[model samples]
Target: MRRNMCRNMCRNMCRNMRRNMCRNMCRNMRRNSERGPTARNRQQRNLKIVDYFRQVFGEWAQVEVVELVNDGSGLAFGIVGGRSSGVVVKSVLPGGVADRDGRLRSGDMLLRIGAVSVVGMCARQAACVLRQCGACVRLLVARPAPSNAAPLQSLGASQAPIVPSRLLADPLDLERRLAEAGHDGFGALCEDTTPTSPPPTVIEESLHHRVRELLTAFKKKLWF
Candidate 1:
């Protein structure tokens, strides 16, 4: 009876192992197929839409850059659009890079992907433009303007192109601001000038307290 039970247990374990291996293999195969020619054909079709937009809009389309990192898995967002509606974000997958970034939202109009324009393209075309973007994707999306803001002026020979009201800070500008703000860390929290003379005990304690207060305020600014 003991021998029979042991054999049964071994058989069950072997069956589970085989099932797991098969499941993994199938998943890998599916991924490879997606990464193959079917994927390339899909991409090509999307690029055609991008080209059509470039021909129509030319360089006059207003756009802003939002950078996102793709972790092997595709940028997780669904798009829906056409010539009438233009390419619009339909949904953002939870826990995906787009969701985590918090910049993209459903109904945001896609302007361009990387160097190519998708302004007037459909969803499939817009997605194709995304596939060409290697690892780091630079998306140009336009959110709805504020309700109180003036309506966008029609394009004309006399008018300069309209720029978005809010723009992401340039990397160089951010670095310069950080330098102006001074270094982070407890030691650099506050500057000390009178190193030649020792500060009074009470004064020293007050200075330390002031440093903690300033640090807390700075952190709050960063968090919010």
Candidate 2:
């Protein structure tokens, strides 16, 4: 009888330990969920600032010459716009050289690779230039200029072409341009999108699944 009692106590202790662990994990997940979005927004804001600096200042912007060491994964070319308009970075791969340095942004335009000018080169040619740089390479990047302004028509003889107060293109106009270039809506300008909801992270999904499993197990234990 004493042995059976001791065995029951041991099982109870084990059950209690597991319950406590699950509770602790749930609390930690709640804390992370509460804090994650704010941190993410701040990081995104910083990246936007970097892009803004490039856009407003263009080539006149103080050049940031970044030397990236290739680890054989090759440079992540985000988006190369057609007609040599310039390449726009769509996204930087997590943990890559570009991401680690934190200089390259999603909308930054490629200006030059080492001494080679990338101004008029197509996307294929630009990739080739990057490849030739080999193990280590320096990159010059700028923010893409606002492409919204209709080409200023030449005024006859003595008249100056009228300019709009805001040179920044309308969001719809930018979207149309992207569509015309055969982009299936991926690189929409940052200002164009509406904030709907944040996507769930892997950690959040796993935590939710674990919580559901724990609850199911608890229910089964009660039934038994």
Candidate 3:
């Protein structure tokens, strides 16, 4: 009887040991996961894409902008992934100052506005800031490669930055200001060749916008 009891005790002890080991292992995993993505890891990540874009373009690179052009295709999507995920641009108003500048495309990331550097801000936040600042805005951005290649780096900036600008912006989306200004919805650029009164030469504005249109369209189509 004692022998049988001893065997049962030994088995219970072994089982208990295993259960404790598993519990400890699980706890460690939970702790590590809770820590989340490290700051160093995030920094080392191919981030700072806009800053790199600014360098690729000249110190005077400008972002092309059309006012009040969401380019959302009738969707109510908030900003994508995280603000740090991609480059952001200044929002445009419908038939406003920036729009008069030229055909500004959505999805372009804004690098520098006039004298300010907008490297690490969310798109909406950046746009709000731009609207607060009056007059013309100069922006530098990165255009995805023409061949539709999966851009150069994994996360950060691009090799060749693109710059576009708009003089006397059309206040793309000043929210309350838009209502105050009595503006309506916006539309895509017409494919016509009606040469409106030209502003100064374009500082590579369309490149980033064209690339972004592709990305935004692709992602949205996949969702709905």
- Alpha-carbon TM-score of each model against the true structure: 0.39, 0.37, 0.31
Deviation (Å) of 13 in candidate 2: 99
TM-score of model 1 (CA atoms): 0.39
RMSD vs true structure, all candidates: 24.2, 14.5, 19.9
lDDT string for model 1 (1-224, tens) is 99999988976876676556556655664555445557676567556644554443442333334678999776899998785457878999999988998878877667656555554457886786688778998665655444443333343321212233222112223222333434221011122221222235744465556556655664566456
Candidate with top TM-score is 1
Kindly report which residue pairs in candidate 1 clash with one another.
Answer: none
Residue-by-residue lDDT tens digits, candidate 2, 42-70: 66644554355445544332223456888
Name the top lDDT candidate.
2
- Once superposed on the true structure, which residue ranges of model 1 sit more than 4 Å away at CA? 1-63, 148-224
Alpha carbon deviation, residue 82, candidate 1 (Å): 0.9
Kindly list the per-residue Cα lDDT of model 3 for residues 46-165, writing each as its tens digit.
Answer: 345435544444333322323332333321112221345544433555554445545444455554443344444566655554565454444434333344333222322432322221
Report residue 47 deviation for candidate 1 (angstroms): 23
